[model samples]
Target: MSSPSTQPFAMGGREFVAMMASLQALQALAIDAMLPALGVMSHDLGVDGSNERQLIIGIFLIASGLGSLFPGALADRFGRRPVLFVCVGGYVLFSLAAALAPTFGALLAMRACAGVLSSGMIVVSSATIRDRFSGDKMARTQSLVSVVFMIVPMAAPTLGLAVLELFGNWRWVFGIMAGLGAAVFVWAWLRLPETLHPEFRQKIDVRAIAGNMRIAFTTRSAIGYVFALALIQGALFGYINSSQQLVAEHFGAGDLFPLVFGAMAIAMAMANLTNSRIVMRFGARRVSHAAVIAYIILGATQLFFASGEDETIWQFIPIMTLNLCVMGFISANFSAIALQPFARIAGAAASLQVFLRMVIGSVLGALIGQAYDGSARPLAVALVAAGVGCLLLVMFSERGKLFRRLHGQVEQA
Candidate 1:
């Protein structure tokens, strides 16, 4: 593997961002595209409970979280491209297994395995970004990557629905995932270069791995934002797990569920786009701090509306869109901030942080999802509570400080 300094990226900035975004998008597609098929999938697979279908999404995410622990270490030992190929290949195989599963349990098992594989893609992508950039510049690049990343969430359900309409089967979703995985594998094999510095490579030793993981977790400057990211992820995942139910059943959007959900994604994507432009000026901390506070306020307003038994989609969409818009600002900034401290062990640090956030987020999301009672109240409560939890964690991390800029170019606003 050649160092980035010796061998420049074969691709330009736009293609690089696009490839990274596509790697992350595979994970989003695995979840979002399945949302529309949860009902039919449950019925076909003989699942008896409505809430149980939520596991189709929740299990994959939880498993992905657990899987995050290994990829960065492996990428550090090996190289980014090889680890990516392995992940993509495994994802394709598991996706095919899922498409052919005879029962829901088997399908879920396949999903879990596939989730584990896809985590490598996500962690490696982040580590690759970390290898090349840091601080506010990294945040801006991540925001740009996220802008493309948001496209999958915005369109996956609609694409899933189209597949169902065209093919009359839900399993085709997995087939599509497999096809896309293969495509990414080919793309990466052809163009993606190893970004890990040779000097930073560690031998695959248990103690070293443990030590690296510990450093990532114990870093005073980074760990708070890591936990804060987890709290915020809980809210985000809760919405994802419950969104179809909330839109299609609770609010009775029915077939229009995809459109409604896509609209919320658009709100988030726009926020990311705006953040990319302005992040270098205000600094990630200042922008994200303000956004998270706004997130709490929006959550409170959403709760107020959802609390009423008579809450309408009209009451829900606007507040919820605003809530997600703020979320768009929170995630990329938090990730960039949390990752700012690590340079030498970027892969392992990224791995540990991703693991923490994914695990915490998945568990909390599953709990919030299961609390569904034919209304948005449970999700609303979870969102507000997550926002407050994140705020306190951020405060603790910053020693009660907020909006302090670490970058000299970006002044304290």
Candidate 2:
């Protein structure tokens, strides 16, 4: 393993915030950047149907998760900067391919490849932070990241809308993705320095890989964090998969779908805004624990009303907003908590977390989407079930406590 220097890469507060925001902006650019064009992509590629459009989003997530898994081990062995370069380069290439894909299968394949490549950026950014910070500092820094992360995606559809309006094609969205990937690549190449040192960099011995897998399992703290991340992420993925269809098809919102989507996203922004302030004071553990319970209760209530004669758009929007808000809070903190335990092997740990969240979440999202019965009942029930399962997983993994033992706050009591 690479021996990290005691000195962190020094940046002023604003610079650090900018770097973190860049990572989030990159991610937001990938997914939401394409959302406004989902309809156009479907028509151009001959997958011109409402349900089929989700395949575009679902497949990319599945691909990205799988892509990130290997980097964990690779990152521990090789170093951070090089892997980031490779991944960003791959993302740029594949984005171009996706923009130029001639058929439905080709587009799907490109999206999946692009997803896989992008995870490198995702995994490395988190692991890089882990290399230099831990505990309160980690949570606080991550809170800033979570806030920016929340905001970029919130703004993505608007970017896509403007682009789509100008170019009158979804391909332009991929062009933007490609352009951003290239710009970030150049910026990283010029500005980003390697954080991990040679001293602790591990060798790619098969034995070490097996050993880490064993460690991940035996380490209850790590597993608990991973499980919660996976479950909560699955719920979010389900919502993303179903949202455009639900708003337009069920609520008949038409072009105003983006407005509705943005309103709900604003709720998420509020939650992350709250998360930024709350995590440092209350700590990552307590807030994350409470948020899970809040999500479950909120989701169950929404499900109850949605299952009844609540066709009023008024009824749907506020309930959905609350559910998404809680999600925004839980996601970043749970990841920080899970990640706190595995800073030494952050790449592998992040890969495991990413894989479980993406692959499993994608599967669950597809399952729930298939159960869509014209009413919001399917999504509401799915959210509640996911939250309940996630909460239970966290409880069992913690052996009843919700706060992470990994940070050695078990005595906080």
Candidate 3:
């Protein structure tokens, strides 16, 4: 089957990549950018709790995952642009609702709603790429998206910190999310054309839905890789939940915690830039397998350091930063691999894949947060468990295959 583009519109690979990257940017802008404000929100609402701090992160993801299922079913039925427009609109409304929430519970509920809407943005954005690209090109494009993802994250913490310092409150972060949501909605509404063709639309008949789901689940490589990628992402989320506590509380990172986070962000960005160049040449599997191996090695070292030592900031930074850098390659490449087998079912596949990625990752993030004991032990343990498991699964699923195996595969229909 041919990929999405026929004539290759004015915004082909580069524009598509940049635009898709905005979806990730919007997410980071929503969650991470709101973090510094969580304390203020809790204090303002008289919430007076510790978990409220992480609620800013967790609630958004929970809602996003729940919101993903329908858009997949709808996107191919109606067309991508419509779904994109609605999702972005949903994000804007919910972000504003969150900003205006009168009580802590109201704000939390709105945050959850925002996540639900945001998931549509995430799912459709990936589907847009599947419409236009496939195989190693798809992986490379995703790598560029990963780079944009990291760049936004690198700035988000510092930005949030600055806004909190100047404004002395958290609602401004939500205000920013509202503004961004509005701008992106306008940009996408104007620039993105309808990519799904009428002939390709799947009616929402039971038989059609069942047939699509069966096709998605029956694809061995795609299913295996999606679960594997989700497991890896769960590990990443664990780090996200624990990183600040680990750095600030355990390592005495103080206000410099953002700097530490920024350093790791830089490492992840470098890996993405490297993947963008080589993923096309080597294919995603060759790149991913190597990166997973590196991830396992790095994770094991971190686990060892935490096992016995009064570990200093110097010790943790090197190993944890290395692990995250390797993950940039693993995250996008594994996703590209997982989605490579179904063209007709690309939206369904991305939806399911993203759902599990969120569900599993959020759970792991919660688990790590629960295990928090004023130490880095929980983060290190979760990473080692999740990272090594991902490597083993990749080995088993592919039967020692890498990019060489893709010579005969679809990468996605």
Number of the top lDDT candidate: 1
Each model's lDDT comes to 0.90, 0.76, 0.77
| Alpha-carbon TM-score of each model against the true structure | 0.97, 0.93, 0.95
Clashes of 1: 0
Candidate 1 Cα errors over 4 Å, as ranges: 1-6, 408-413
Can you write out model 3's per-residue Cα lDDT over 1-413, one digit (the tens) per residue? 34554334676666667778887688777866765455567788887666546776787776777777778878878778788888888888888888788988898899888888888888888877777777887788888988877877787878888978888776677777888879878877777777665556788777886677677767777767777777777777766766666776678987887777887898999999999998878878888888878887888788788877587888889988888888888988888777777677777777887887888778777777767777677778877788777877776668766555376664433
Top of the candidates by TM-score: 1
True-vs-predicted CA distance for residue 341, candidate 1, Å: 0.7
Give the poorly placed runs of model 3, Cα more than 4 Å off.
5-8, 400-403, 410-413
lDDT by residue for model 1 over 1-413, one digit each (tens)? Answer: 11262256778889989999999999999999999999999999999697999999999999999999999998889978888889999999999999999999999999999999999999999999988888888899899999999999999999999999999999899999999989988998898877888887877999988988888888777888889889888888888898888889988999999998998898899999999999999999999999999999999998998888799999999998998889989999999888877777778988999999999999999999999988989988988898999999899888999999974332110
Better of 2 and 3 by TM-score: 3
Rank list by lDDT: 1, 3, 2
Model 1's alpha-carbon lDDT is 0.90
Please give the distance, in angstroms, between residue 171's alpha carbon in candidate 2 and its true position after superposition. 0.5
Residue 107's lDDT within candidate 1 is 92
Tens digit of per-residue lDDT, candidate 2, span 204-264:
8889876765665557765776777777777777777777778766888777777778778
